[model samples]
Structure formats: C-alpha cells, structure tokens
Target: MSGTTWAAIDLHHHVVPREYAKALSKLGVTEGLGVQLPKWEASKALDVMDAHGIARSVVSISAPGVYFPAKDPTSAVAKQLSRAMNEACAALVRDHPGRFGVFATLPVPDVDAALEELRYAFDELH
Candidate 1:
C-alpha cells in the first residue's frame, strides 16, 4: 500500500435525523435486529468522529431504512421517509462544513421514486 496519511473517512456511518427518529418511535420500532436504536445527535456524532480521528463521515439511514409496515405494496411511506431523511442529511452537510457528507436515501424497490430522488439529490441537494 502507498504510505499516505489523510484524515479518516467513515463510509458507512448511520445518521438518525430527528424527525425520522420520531417517526420510527411512533411506528413502535423500539428495537430490531436484536438491538435497540441508540440515541444520535450531531454533537454526539462529531464527538465520536473526533475520538476516532475521522475527518469526515458519509451518512445515510441504516438497516430497516425508510421502508415501513412490510405489508404496504405501494411503498408510499418509504418515499416520504426517504425524502425527509435526505433533506435532513443535506441540511447537516450544509450547516457543518467539512464534518459530514451524505449518501442520499432513495425509496428503493420503487423505481419511479428512486429515479426522482436520485435526480433531486444530485441536482438539488448537493
């Protein structure tokens, strides 16, 4: 490997935007995948990043993602969740300067919504 040093980049960092967390709580998703959702805040995340010497973190919604009520075939809720999540992440990046980046959530399995989000994310959110 080329010996080089650059500030660390955390590629798979998860960010629970405030509204998203509230939405999840309302949905009764206290825990899943054998783990309760931990509290997260921008200040707390920055602290963790500093402790780990991470110069930047690319944030996105983690597992279980924006989808909800597995029975819904229309994926209507997922689209809304993805939009809010992406907007929040974009706001963080805009406000925090160099501390964070975004992966841009998409309402997946929904081709039309995903395409719209992809276009909006790159063209507008960035």
Candidate 2:
C-alpha cells in the first residue's frame, strides 16, 4: 500500500467577512441560534489553520443561510444575500491564493436566482 500523507482540508469552514457582518448588522440580525455572531478575522483563520496543519479550507455560509426575514416566502432577500456572500468568498479566494476555496452559497427555494448564481460562480468567480 502506498500511503501518502496530505495536509488536512476543512470542508465546513465558515468565514464571516467584515463586510458581511456589517450588512447583517444593518439588517438587525445581530444573532442567530440565540447567540451573537462572533467576529472573524482572515488572519486569525490562517493562523489557526497553520497551527493545526490544515493546508486548505473550503469556506461556506453558516446556518439559517442567506435567507432572512423568514416571513418573506418569495426569497428575494435570500438571493441578494447569497450573491453578496458568494462575491465575498470569491474575493477571499482571490486574496488568499491557495489557502481558501468556496463552496458557493445559493438562495434556495428560489430556483431562478440559484441557477443564475450557479452559472456566475462557476463561470466567472472560479
């Protein structure tokens, strides 16, 4: 058996970019899951990864996803939020070189927006 060791890849990493956190704050969503959203720093993330021997991390938006104001069944806000998060992720990947990759969040229950975002993320962002 040829056993080759490779650096760890964290598939479930979450990065709440500074801009995204501000946007949420503007929307009055200060907390989710009964706790305030914690601050995140890209430099801190890299440090932790380095300490833990993780070479790459695929980042994604956390729970409750892009959808907000749950009463709005149209998912309009979800689409907008998803686009912002994806764009931010793309920027992070651009800035971090090989250290980060994106899972690409989609605005679910809104098929058309999701499809459009999928195309943009794969074609342009990647």
Candidate 3:
C-alpha cells in the first residue's frame, strides 16, 4: 500500500448542536442514555477527523433523540427542535464543504411533521 492515498468517510458521527443543547438544558435534560451529553464543537471534530484521516463525516444527533419525556412526542416543540437541528447540520455542511454532511433530524412520533421535515431536508437543505 505504498504511496496509496485514502479518503475515508465516517458514517457514524454525532453532533450536539448548540441550540439543541440549550433546548435540552431548558427542559432539564442534562444527559442522554445514562451518559452525560458531550460538548461537540466543529473545530474539534475537524481536528479529530484530520488526525484520523477522515475526509468526510455524516453527522446526526445522538441518543435521547428529539423526543423529550416531558413533552408529548407529537408536540410542536419536537417538530421545531427537529427543524432547528437539521438546519444546524445543514449549516455545518455548508460551512465545511466536503468535510461534513448531515443526517437530517426528524420529529418522530409526529408522522406528519416528520414527513414534512424529511421533505424539507432533502429538497431545501440538500
């Protein structure tokens, strides 16, 4: 494999958008899936990717997802959160060009809203 160059793609990457974190904090959610939430920053992620020789990473929100236990799964708040997160991911992609891609967030349990967000993510964001 001498002189070979590899462009790696990381499919399982997680991102905690700033706004999403704040929203979760406001809702008194400081952790997810029995672990403390990670503080994700784009510069740090990029540095790690460079060290790992990763050319691109497709990122999504981690556990606890978009549904808050205190709020109904079908609540508008979930939809709003999903939209905000997806938009944030899209921004990352836009800002980083080939370095980042988004695994769009959806408001699950709210079928209609999820579908709407899916369409928006693919059509508008992409």
Q: Which candidate leads the pack in TM-score? A: 3
Model 2 alpha-carbon miss at residue 21, Å: 1.6
Candidate order by decreasing lDDT: 3, 1, 2
lDDT of 1 by residue, 1-126 (tens): 599777899999997676887877776776546677767799999999999899999998766677775644688878888888989999999889998999989988888999999999999897
Candidate 3 has a TM-score of 0.93
Model 2, 23-112: lDDT tens digits are 777767777677777788889999999999999999997654677755557787778788889998999899999999999889886788
Ranking by TM-score: 3, 1, 2
Superior by TM-score: candidate 2 or candidate 3: 3
Off by over 4 Å in 3: 1-3
Deviation (Å) of 76 in candidate 3: 1.5
Query: After aligning candidate 2 to the native by TM-score, how far in Å is the CA of 82 from where it should be?
Result: 1.1
RMSD of 1: 2.3
Cα-based lDDT at residue 46, candidate 3: 99
**Candidate 2 residue runs with Cα over 4 Å from true position:** 1-5, 69-73
lDDT of each: 0.84, 0.83, 0.89
Report clash pairs, candidate 2.
Answer: none
- Per-residue lDDT, model 2, residue 51, is 98
lDDT of 3 by residue, 1-126 (tens): 999998899999999888988988877887888898999999999999999999999999987788874665447778888999999999999999999988889888778889999999999998
Predictions: Cα RMSD each: 2.3, 2.1, 1.4
